[model samples]
Target: MISYRWLLFIVLFVGIFATNYLAMTVKEPLAASAAFTLMVLSVYGLEKFYNRGPEKVTDERTDLINMKAFYYGSLALIVTLMFEFIWLVSEDYETAVLMAKYLLMPFGAMIAVVVLSKAYLERVM
Candidate 1:
């Protein structure tokens, strides 16, 4: 049977290709490609970390760490959203519409915070 890791890798590869292709069609292809390369490397490193050991069952400590990480992540998301709201409020309609493309930034920040906090908590506690 196919593994989840392979599936994730395949999806990421497809996304990378699609992103680069679209980026090449845009004006700043070089900058986009550089950013994409960095993102790919980061994902590859994370994949290596995940596959470094056999999967383990979650325990009580793990649960506690995740809960706290989630709390911190949610707080970050709230703060990010507040900033986004202020930016939107201060902009004209056209500018606001343009900035709306970054609506996912807060979600991305939340995910990053959650992942980083969970890793730190695991090491500390």
Candidate 2:
């Protein structure tokens, strides 16, 4: 099983190598870098599925704790979304669109966290 540290190192190394390769071989490197990021994230996602561990008990106590953590995480995500929204609104439409593109991943992650955590909370609580 690949541990977190090794996964991190592998992603980091591939990112650096891909970036350097693009810099040396391509006229523009942004697309290559962005592609590398998506690739790395995809790999990490596959790793999660491949290395998924055993299930645990879903008792009320665990649900309560998880619910609290989800609430806090949601609050944090809300704050970040607010900040990004404000920043996006302050910019021109083109700039706002670009900014939103960068924010999309975190927003999606927050949505996933909320969905999964609430699912678990509802299942137990």
Winning candidate number (lDDT): 2
* Residue 91, model 1: Cα distance from true site in angstroms: 23
How good is model 2 by TM-score? 0.38
Highest TM-score scorer: 2
What are the models' TM-scores?
0.34, 0.38
Q: RMSD to native for every prediction?
A: 10.5, 9.6
Report clashes for each candidate as comma-separated counts.
Answer: 0, 0
Looking at model 2, the pairs that clash are none
Clashing residue pairs in candidate 1 (N, C-alpha, C atoms within 3 angstroms): none
- Candidate 2 per-residue lDDT, tens place, 35-60, comes to 45565566668667767998686877
The per-model lDDT (C-alpha) reads: 0.60, 0.63
